[model samples]
Target: MLKFDIFLSALANGLMTGAVYALIALGLTLVYGVLHIINFAHGATLTAAMFAVFVAHSVFKIDPYLAIVMLTPLFFGLGYAVQRFVINPASHGNDSNILLVTLGLSIIIENALLAGFRSDTRSIDVPYGFSVIEIGNLFLSTPKVVAFFASFVVAGLLWLLLARTDTGKAIRAVAREKTGAALSGINVDHIYAVTFGLGAACLAIAACLLMPTFLVNPRIGNAFVLVAFTIVVLGGMGSIAGALVGGLIIGVVESLSGLYFGESLGQIGIFLIFILVLLFRPTGLFGAKA
Candidate 1:
């Protein structure tokens, strides 16, 4: 009975953590869908957004949620400019070059952050940071619940935006085929910028929502990127729904493994699962047939 209770607790926490992972993976998958290029700098961009929100709270005493509102447009512009200037140049015939450019951008951003922030850990000091609620035999942290719900809401909103808007249709067209989209009067380059901006905005939102629950450091993004990649692959490289389900599966697996096997071994087990998924279902659970 005690072991079962423990498993239940782990499951609850796992679900919450999985929601956070899903948000991150959604951004990655969005870029992949539109550009057909992996944005390796995604984690770095998320870390930067975290730091931006942290600064807003620390320096201006803004609420973290309010900080997200303020920073969203800022990051959107940054993303637009980045895609317009830096990424678009390399986004030519060579898709591999896009990967190389993003990888280089990640390194540069990480090093810049280390230089600026000195590799120190930081966190948002929100009122509900350590608050939790107990329901019978189970415990649930307030921040984790908030993160989970917020992630779902954001993801749902994104889906609606893509499914309902004119701009979204253009983006979808570009994602389906750039040259064809351009011939059909869609500005492919503009669509690319908008897609990248939206993806960056999602990362910023995720960073802000998660700030109170996790430590922020220059390298924190690195820790989550692999998990994000795993989620992406498991879901199907560019499938939004895949990211959601994949993230939840990983979270539950990690939670159960940690509860039964031990912490270090749990991570190893998750990686093993990732490997198996890659070997067996490289197209992912929802990935379109290639």
Candidate 2:
């Protein structure tokens, strides 16, 4: 049997990690929710954002936490322009074309990062990076705990954005029926861009939150992309709530699996559960049936 302290420690770690995972998945899921397409460039966008945070901290002397204020809108605008000009114009209403464009964009972004930053893995050293919160016998990393709470705040804000605002209503209308939304004078293309921007903005926030705890490289985001996709599928393709719940569950499972089976096999459990979810519940825990 596992020791109570050890198990509790793992569980706490899982939740903290899971919260950040959910934040990352929120971007991908939000894009899918509105655009109905898997953004192949999402992980790359995250990579870019992390680099932005890095640049802000190392060069501009802005704190990673403070970088959020600057980078989020910048990325949002970048996302908006990409969707408005590059993706929307090139795709011509075809899903496959959007996929290709995003894939191409990902390749370009990764290569740019490689050329600029090389393949070296970089990490930041904030003053509080080593700080931890002690509770009984458990010590939680401070950055991770802050990330945990911040994830909820972002999710809640996103929910309110979708539920309470006029833009949000327009987004929902376009998501549900693009033609009807357009006919109703809802500027579908603009809404599409906005949704995509929102997705990228989420990535910016996540990058900031993750920088203090995680390492960054051109390829680091790729490591999370598959896991994000799994969370997307597990929680339902377009279900925000599902993404949040699935992330936590996967985090816990990965933690426990790592504890028992070792690091190399830790990811196996995640995929196993993913496969089972696919086979048994293709619609996912919160997805609507097609």
Candidate 3:
């Protein structure tokens, strides 16, 4: 009975953590879906957005949730500029060139953050940030609960945008085939920027939701980006729904592993599952063959 309770607790927490993980993976998958290049700078963008929240909290005494309104456009614009200026010019280059360029950008962003913010850790101090709710033998984190529900809401909205909107149709068209999309009158470059911006925008929302629970630092992106990658690959490189499901699965496995083995072994479980998936389904659970 005690063991079962522990399992339940772990499962509850895992789902909450997975919600945030899905949001992060959504951003990554979106960029990869359209650009055909992984944004290595994604983690840095997350780090930046978290730091932006910290700035709003410190300088203006604003709550992290509300800060999303101010930060989203800025983050979107940054994504737009990076795609338009840095990435677009290199679109004609090989995959290696694109990867190296984004990786370089990531390094620069991390180091710039290190120089600016120093090594000290920072975080928001909301009263309920660390609060917990109890149900029977299970305990749920308030922040995680909030972040989890918010992620679902955002996911639903994203689905609506993609399924029902014209701009969303343009983004999907480009993702399917750039040249084909261009021939059909889509401004491929413009759509690319918008897609990148949308991806970045998702990260901003995640950053704000996560700020209350996570510590801010230069290397913080390093902490979660690997998991984000795992989720992205496991779900499918370009599948948004797959990312969400993958995030939840990874989260549950991680939580259970930590409980039975140890915290360090949790990552091993992820790798094992990832390897199996690669062996059996290289295109991923949701990815379609080209």
lDDT per residue for candidate 2 within 1-290, as digits (tens), equals: 43998999999998888888898898898889889899999999999999999888889889999998899999999999999999999999999999999999999999999999999999888999989999999999999999999999999999999999999999888888999998999999999999999999999999999999888999988988888999999999989999999989888988999988998998998899899999999999999999
- The better-scoring model by lDDT among 1 and 2 is 2
Winning candidate number (TM-score): 2
lDDT tens per residue, model 3, 116-226: 999899877988887998889888888888999999998888888988998899899898787888898999889989888988899999999999888999989877788
Stretches > 4 Å off in candidate 3: 90-93
The better-scoring model by TM-score among 2 and 3 is 2
**Once superposed on the true structure, which residue ranges of model 2 sit more than 4 Å away at CA?**
none
**Candidate order (lDDT):** 2, 1, 3
Go through the candidates in order and give the clash count of each.
0, 0, 0
Weakest ten-residue segment in model 1 by summed lDDT: 264-273
Q: How do all models score by TM-score?
A: 0.96, 0.98, 0.96
